[model samples]
Target: MSSSTQPSDIIIGRTFGALFIGVTIAAVLFGLSCVQSFVYFQTHRDPGTTFYKLVVICLWILDALHLAFIVHCVYYYLVSNYANITAPMDVVWSFKLQILFEVLIIQGVHSLYLYRIWIVSQGRSRILPIIVGIVIMSNSGVAIALIWALYQCSMFSELNKIEWATFLTLGTITFADVVIASSLCYLLATSRTEFSSTNSLITRLMVYIINTGCLTSMCSMAAIITCAVMPTNFIFVAIEFLLAKLYVNSYLALLNARYYTEVNTDTNNSDTFHNRHGVYRPELHVRALDDDELQVSRKDLFKHLDDTVHPSRSVKEPALAVTTEMNSFSSV
Candidate 1:
């Protein structure tokens, strides 16, 4: 092979190799998210709202489809079309399907966060939701247009031909993520109760909001920058492949946190129940409540507490259990 052929080979290898690696990593994450979803549904069967459960299921399906589509793209590029007397490959229909699935995954996750914002704000502000909603919808629209334009382009090398649309779509996604993180952190901070346990839960939630939201936005920014700098290269495509997985994994992480917290809380409650009945652990300060308080659902128990109740006694009563339950509930 000539020297010219070597460079061509390297470029082809790099492009398809990066995609293969990205798809593999994304598939692993998707599989993990599926396991997490299963455990999540089993542990927290009642996600309070049917909508929340539906979101989880939808996200899972979208992520799976995204992974499958990418795998097919890889196979077609590397095997089926391998022998074509090719220059750089053109964006095929499989690639378009991948982009569409990505858009769906992103939009679904964004909607989930928007719902969180509404709940965290106690439905008080219509303004934030409307603003964020517009941004999300606009981003999705631009993304679709970009994909359409991508198909119209004669070659993948001409990605820069639709540069404006590309940047707008990515920039909008990053902006939406920033707005979501800031809104969630601010609202959650303001809603904090003076109770120690509640504060602990809120702190964890805030950390989750920041980590997930920031990481996704940063990935988006990276993709946008890469595309701007090297539109003809597959570098941006490699990064873009990771975005959907990151979003899904982040959302799944938030859900899994609830499950672990519930398990811990249940252990504490069982220990308390056992102690109160037979062997009392004085260090825990667990009090023996009447059957009524015990029978009262965790949701109702919180409503039963008055503002003036002592913190120590409240911890020993149903209050602590309710706190754990509510933390899991509200954080979702």
Candidate 2:
């Protein structure tokens, strides 16, 4: 059979093919996140309150649904009865479910960061929280625009409208991520205590805030650039597909770090600063409060530490440590 396909059509198909690969990788990361989450539940006998458990459960459900929808989109393109029609790419309905799921996942991850900032600030900062809330709402609005674009846009010529949505959504997310990372770093810096151990712990947390926030922010920026440069191409789609995986993985890494930190803290070892890999582990020390004076809840401990102290690592191995340490000061 001989056929002449438009260059644009070929580009679209190739983009979808690349998207399939990206989605597959995302699915694998999702599985890894689930495994980490399960280990977290098993290891931390007293992880947190029921609300935290509920959030984890909801994230699991969202992850499962996200994967399912992506798989369906792939199947539709690769094996469905309408596969020969090239309808999947031309129709908005084909991708709305996946896009919706992506938005929900992003929102959940963003909310977690907001919670971190709120706790770290001890609810004192009025402006930063409001900015984050506004950014989140803006991102949500972009998601709605995306859905509307998908619904109203039925062909390649109409992709211009969706491009605007893509730009706004990704730009807002990147802005929000930068805000989170910078805010955490500032708060942690100001919260440093005179005690070496507590300062070490805060330093560790600052590392994580940088890695996690920078990672997501960078991903979102890359997506925004691609979307802007090649609004009609699928390259942006491929890049954006990984956003959810990054979000889920970053959060899971934090949870796993909490487990390792608890084990180290309870061992009562002097060189708790370094782990088996010789990486500086974040260790916390309670100085002012005598053992009998007050029993500190993890949340209270972080709050009390933040109230009392003020201020203040490397890359390579240290970067690995920061990425590995997921337990924020609140969890400690």
Candidate 3:
């Protein structure tokens, strides 16, 4: 090949190669998410979890559609236009429509995280949720603007015209992830109980929250950096293809974690405790509670702690205190 055509060949390789790698990773994540959803529905048959099951179903459908769009875009560029040297520069309809699915998936996952923060803080921390909500909404707007810009342009190189939108969208997403993770960590740390087991569980939850947030944030940062450094390549587009799958998989992981926590809690503690009469008494056997009930249980935990510290001054029987054993992310 002549020297003049070498750069074109390299660009083609990078453009299609990135798309292939991204779609491959996304397919793997999607498969894992499907397994998680199946396990969740098979195990959690309670009426309280119906809403969560529906959310999972919706996300799975969106993810499947998103993957289809990516596949079509790649096939259109690489297979259908195999002999066309200028094919990589042309834009496809699937490329623009995928932005809509991406924005919707992100909105759903971020909303769930916000709800968890609300429950963990017992509705006391309003400022953080409001700020995160605003950022998320702004990001959605930027995504729409980006789609519009893509629609207006016939060539991939034209994306530079609305580069600001791309930067804003990724920046807002990273900001929201960081804020949500930090808020959850702070709230969980402050909710530590006197019992070591309870505190340990809270610490585990904090670590999980941080890891989930960091994964998504790192992906967004990678996309942003690639877009800025190589505006003419499709590496950023490839990263975008994986973003929805990451969000869906993370949400499913959060939900499925409850089963492991419940098993661990039950196995570590005895079902019955000896009372003051030296007789074995059955522990309070309430079903797993949702977020609202979890909040009530937390209050009972604090009240029980107070009574234990000052038994002589207490008048009423102690409230049932098993909040520590319950999974913090049980509902949201």
Candidate 4:
């Protein structure tokens, strides 16, 4: 609790300030992209009113909100760290709200992707494939609390003592997210035809998810070891901000790359697919992953995963449906 043990707080005013500014811009760009995408989808609906379509729409909205939240955090991180170092307990409690929202952000990612993989894999896989998302969300909740402690508890020097249990709990949860995500990738990879029906969109997505998870895991490890490593200095906290910026920005890049355009070739079908109202537009199909080599590639990726899935599991008309949809929309 002594001043000597306090972290060597850096002059984060400018650094965090710049980050806040940049992320706020990114948030705006993200919002713009979301609007653009919504307009496009609203112009092209084929399957009519379906629950799955609604789910995808919800994911996009949540993602946009998540970006906005990141912008908010960027501001708070700077403001809280220096401008107002000593917040009243009630204010600190309010700050915890932002930290808790971080969990919701991550949970949004899981909910959006987990079900897709399950459906693509035909709902016939290990139970971990299904419930692992819940575990991920649960642990994220714990991480949020611990994350709050890292800041808010530090507000009260006497209560700054961190719990190892909390560390392990959150760490384990991160590991679980990684493991399940990897499994999802493998399941898709080995599915009878590489992801041919889905094009590289799904594969790109899976790779991006893997990369994000790995980086997040690395950040968590660095954080957990900070106690034994530097033990002092705002260095760890600064690193944390940097990692967070990377996580959010990288995700935005993925959104832009994955959703900003009709990357794949698949948009032929139109079932009132979000086209504002009842409208007719084409769908997009990524590319063909229907060859044996692609299948082999899939097999290789999932070599370590234990799912019994195979390339033959791929649906026969996934590409056709996508291609027809894309062509149909383009013609519109």
lDDT of 2 by residue, 106-206 (tens): 88888876766665555466787777778877777877887777777666556665676777778888887888778767877876544444455667767
Candidate 3 has its poorest 10 consecutive residues by lDDT at: 305-314
C-alpha lDDT (0 to 100) for residue 184 of candidate 3: 68
Cα-based TM-score, every candidate: 0.78, 0.75, 0.78, 0.53
TM-score of 4: 0.53
* Local lDDT at 209 for model 2: 66
Regions more than 4 Å wrong, model 3 = 1-10, 47-49, 123-125, 271-332
lDDT of 3 by residue, 145-168 (tens): 776776888766667777888888
Q: What is the lDDT of residue 130 in candidate 3?
A: 78
> Measured by TM-score, how close is model 3 to the native structure?
0.78
Model 4 has a clash total of 42
**lDDT (10s digit) by residue, model 1, range 30-63:** 8888887887677656436565567778888898
RMSD (CA, angstroms), candidate 4: 10.5
lDDT of each: 0.69, 0.64, 0.71, 0.49
Q: Write the per-residue lDDT of candidate 4 for residues 1-332, one digit (tens) a residue.
A: 22333233433443345446546555565565466445545644665665534544655565555555555555455565545544311124433454454455455555545554554465456675557666666666666667656564635333336655345644764676577667666764564343444445456656776776776677667756663454433333334333333444444444443343233322422322335355432322123323233334433333222233332333444545544544455455
lDDT, residue 299, model 3: 35
Q: How many Å off is the CA of 178 in candidate 2? A: 0.4
Pairwise lDDT winner, candidates 1 and 2: 1
